[model samples]
Target: DCKKAVSGKSFYAMEGKPVCPKCVGVDEEEEEEEEA
Candidate 1:
């Protein structure tokens, strides 16, 4: 889905547009907590 992350970065390009987790309400801190 749009949540897909490239490498460890929070941004990527899709269909010539920039996509970010934050735009979809994905918190990076929460992801780190879940990973831990």
Candidate 2:
């Protein structure tokens, strides 16, 4: 699970809020591509 977070393969959350740094990075990248 930790490895997945580090690699941005999955996201972690607490109380329904995202807590994984890598997931945020991956999400941002996806959003940028979508905008493009």
Candidate 3:
């Protein structure tokens, strides 16, 4: 999972949750492929 910094803490954006900017691209690609 991609780690995001929030108030100096680490965050992991899951598959369905609202993804952090660093993870958006990767998640989008996988999501679209899975739906197809």
Candidate 4:
């Protein structure tokens, strides 16, 4: 996992859950993809 801060990069973008901007570019994970 990325250790970079994604505060202003994607603050409150997905409800109240804060996601890492570094990992945003990665789409190899099918975890949330299946649910979405």
What total of clashing residue pairs does each candidate reach? 0, 0, 0, 0
Cα miss at 36, model 2 (Å)? 40
What C-alpha lDDT, on a 0 to 100 scale, does residue 10 get in candidate 2?
49
lDDT of 3 by residue, 1-36 (tens): 545644533334567554455455443223435543
TM-score of each: 0.29, 0.24, 0.21, 0.24
Residue range 1-36, candidate 1, lDDT tens digits: 454545675674556666675665555556454542
TM-score of candidate 1 against the unseen true structure: 0.29
- lDDT of every model, 2 decimals: 0.58, 0.48, 0.47, 0.47
Model 2 misplacement above 4 A: 1-7, 21-36
Among these predictions, the greatest lDDT belongs to 1
Q: Which ten residues in a row have the lowest lDDT in candidate 4?
A: 6-15
RMSD of each: 7.8, 6.6, 8.8, 8.2
Measured by TM-score, the strongest candidate is 1
Residue-wise C-alpha lDDT for candidate 4, range 1-36, written one tens digit per residue: 344564445432344455564455544333455534
Runs of candidate 4 with Cα error greater than 4 angstroms are 11-19, 26-36
Task: Return model 3's CA RMSD, one decimal.
Answer: 8.8
